[model samples]
Target chain A: MSHDAHVYSKSQTEYEYTRRVRREAMRGQVTTFAIMIFLTLIAFSAVAAGFSEYFIVPILLLLAAIQVVLQLYYFMHMSEKNHGMAAFFLYSGAILGFTLFLTFLTIVWWN
Target chain B: MDFNTKYTPQSWPDHPEQVTLEGKNKFLGFWLFLAGETVLFSSLFATYLALKNKGPSGMEFSTQTLFELPLVFVMTMILLTSSLTSVYAMYHMKNHNFKGMQTWLAITVILGIAFLCLEIYEFNHYVHLGFTYGQSAFSTAFFTLVGTHGLHVAIGLGWIILLLIRNAKRGFSLYNAPKYYTASLYWHFIDVVWVFIFTVVYLMGVVG
Candidate 1:
């Protein structure tokens, strides 16, 4: 309830545990950053290569999707525990957004 | 304001931002707000996709003609790097290193400003080429979708600047940890949106 309510003094075991967690997190961040940069490079190159629209479009979207996931999980820390509510709302919103996209593609644009 | 029992912890082993109750609420509420934003942006994207390239006769410009890849590419890199910088800020926040967090945040803000400036210049270039918002349906949708994103970046820049100034003297406390955390989350969300924009709008336009 208080700011100091949770004790800050950590035993050796707790300190090691925190250290390990942090090390893993740092690794994840570095790896994710590298992959995201690579993905962006691929996306740009795909367009620049002058491939057919059919070939480039799908690949671009797929790369973008992967990059977004990396951004959410690694950068935004959404993959960490205690984020169930956040993940739930995000997925729900994504589904709804997809449906909206479909409606426009199928009905609004066609008409 | 109970100073006696509210000493800053020497270590934050558990949840750093959620050490206090306010952080939990802010974290939850900010996610909900982002959910709404997801839908908000999706609707705009859908509208833009549907209406894109549907301009009336003699007014239609091919996506390749309207977009220049080099400029957009630089802007994308700027925003993406900013996202990574914010992640570093959050890492420092969890470690209870206020100076480290502020340094990374300052870097993030600078990167964000650079991106916004490039976007502005990109828009100006387009207008000079006569791709005004009222020029066509595609133009309108383009501006609305990308402009919405630009507005988010501008707002984020202002938000981070204000936080930096306001918290300069205060440093990191349980009271303000949530504020910084939520702002970083917002910045990451904007980056996520830009990823899609680059893929769907600029890349797709030029390639498709």
Candidate 2:
């Protein structure tokens, strides 16, 4: 069976509007990148400044969590519509992964 | 429509990557694969965390002394920038600018190569300092964890390069659009893993 994809060309104004919208989205992505860089800087500086391990470790992990969320939602487009199934699969994996972390850290350390 | 159906920017669908049955299936299936990958990496991370700094008696090497922050910092920046470049490439793809997408992807490949080079240098430096793979339990765990990530980076670079060359002659099409989109998604996932690596392994290592 053949699938026929109908092509409908946009008018000049419509094309221009779509282009502008894409450009705006790109700008937002760039801003997200900048924030990731800033977070990296703070993580590095916090360690270099010789802060208490207790204080620095949590902050570092927090920054990493924030960065990963941004990467997932923005860069990976998980924030977009029609991603319900995708989100479900990913979060399930994430929950299992978190369980693994807790098990290893607690059980292995205790033993 | 035929897989080879041609279209100008004006005729191209807004979400060309997901416009067809195959594209939609590929999109969902790839995310499932990514979810599995997350589980795989989590296991590795767990193993590394448990075995970290646990070596034979009188062992000298540890995370604090072995890792150099400056080198890791630079590598982080390069990889982060490369991720954004791939985002730019996708933006160009959405705009149906084939040349623009290719150029940005080329830039991304270059940056990826630079990151790989730094990683090689870092590994070699560690080896010279008596940190070989079989040195100790800690060394094994460290190498296994970070080396797996390095392998992922190498694989991602190869995948993107092959896509760039194979599709060099073919402009944007519904068939190939999902391919590029998935490749970028994988690349971003690599960056996500690195974020955790730097924090859990490098940063925490330094802190302790």
Candidate 3:
């Protein structure tokens, strides 16, 4: 309650501010957690539903991609404001990985 | 551990874990390591995709029979829920709630152990089903990719256990805050890889 307390000493206002940020972050986490579970369910049901392999494969991969992004940004806290370098390296690595895979798919053949 | 608790507003911010110099470096460096791990896993994933089902096509012990959806579903849920529990641990960390953080981390570690046991069972089941490694290129790739992931989970379990034991006495301080934070990040990365394994390796293996 003292205004002239130590500079780094926890003030009522600072406590409220931190609490509010954490509360909002928790909401984001809960929502994404539900969405991730839903996505996983959809992935499982798509297979169980016995659709054409052609139809199921791409859809399964797409859903997995979405879940990966969600896991990275939401649960992993990659979306936070100060994570620029992390995001850069992550996307760069992804792009490089995809490129390598694409090259193999284009060139590698089976008899 | 010489935890330097004193700080000014200029040094400590809303998030104490990330406000220190070492914390900032550790946070950035761990993510970069994870980025490289992404590439590593991707290469393994591509190898698996190319080699899956390439083994002479007529074997009775096909992937479909080998993959137990119910078991995989349970494993996925357990790992996913563990990720959430680690989030709660980090949440408590940000709030400076030491006991809350420790409780959630303990829960996370327990769930991780459960997942590892299930993986061991799954591998045992596969071997019993006569799908041992070296049967074919497909089998080799499958075991390597998934087994690597299982190894990561095992290592993560050990990492958490060591951190919990070492830090239990010290509690939350700036010196150890980044240590706990990075451990959670590693745990989350393991869960992320499992997401792909569940979908790409298990679900798609069953479907396609």
Candidate 4:
């Protein structure tokens, strides 16, 4: 290759270092996913078997909320660097979501 | 608290500066994606709760004959396991174990395929029993909520197929690393959605 070409490639390649390293394992996240699924299915089966109606929705609420946290921290990599910035968007979305759901719930249920 | 400590060096590139940009982007981007999913499921949940009993001609379609604990339970297992398999794929991708990554991705794909098949059968049974979408509000919400989830699975399947094919040769480059990671992220997201669906749609409906 020409000297100029080599120079250009060298500069570019400086950033082109090893791409796939060890960080992507994400085992912690995946394992959490597995456990949530297992527990959720157990709950699903139990409810399908017939349960007191009042307990079903509340228990599901707990499970769903917990799973959301797991997805955020684990799958979505929310705990990584720049998490503060990420959390800004995430918390904004969460607050907005809860507000929306609660607003609707109040309008529909309390009314 | 440092992101670097959270993962092994192999989980990322060797030259840390090369990845800082992408990691930051991903951190925000994936959260935005989750926001959108929240709206999607919330809408489905609202619609289902609203129309769960609105049947045509006063016939009042029901799910008693449509859903079975055993089949849904099986599907739940399949999808959940696929999430684990995807994690393994990501793990290998970080390690730069190209062959191992491919193997795990294939496993995830197979599990996803199995789940989709069971879901198809479940929907078929529902339709056969006159509990189809057009039959009642209940069916409409049921199909739309659950069907949306099914559609996500289908999309996920297509995603992995493309990833598997694309990465077959190139292996795990930085370019490809994020692709697989995001796909797995999506897989877990949809699986999380299913946890709700199984509860609110199948379990809650039946128990109620």
- Among incorrect, acceptable, medium and high, the docking class of model 1 is medium
lDDT of 4 by residue, A26-103 (tens): 545656767787667668766866677786778877877787677667765666665676678656666766566666
Q: In model 3, what is the error at residue B171, expressed in angstroms?
A: 1.3
Give the alpha carbon lDDT tens digit for every residue of B1-208 in model 3.
1254544433344666576677888998988898898898888888888787767567666678678798999999999999999999989887777789899999999999999999998888888877889777888889999999999999988988998899897767778888888999899889889988998888888986
Model 3 residue B91 CA deviation (Å) reads: 0.4
Tens digit of per-residue lDDT, candidate 2, span A1-99: 045746779999999999999889999999999999999999999999999998888899999999999999999999999999999999999999989
lDDT of each: 0.86, 0.93, 0.84, 0.70
Residue B176, candidate 1: Cα error in Å is: 0.5
Of 2 and 3, which scores higher on lDDT? 2
Instruction: Sort candidate 2 into its docking category.
Output: medium
As for candidate 4, its clashing pairs are A21-B10, A21-B11, A21-B94, A22-B10, A22-B11, A23-B10, A23-B11, A23-B12, A24-B11, A25-B91
**Native contacts retained by model 1, as a fraction?**
0.70
Q: Fnat per model, in the order given?
A: 0.70, 0.80, 0.55, 0.36
lDDT of 4 by residue, B110-150 (tens): 99999999999888877787776687767877888899999
| DockQ measured for candidate 2 | 0.75
Per-residue lDDT of model 2, residues B1-208, tens digit only: 5577888899888998888888899999999999998998998999999999889898899998899999999999999999999999999899899999999999999999999999999999999999899999899988898899999999999999999999999999988999999999999999999999999999899999
Which candidate, 1 or 3, would have the higher DockQ against the true structure? 1
**A15: Cα error in model 1, Å:** 3.3
Q: After superposition, how far is residue B39 of candidate 3 from its true place, in Å?
A: 1.1
TM-score of model number 2: 0.98
The candidate maximizing DockQ is: 2
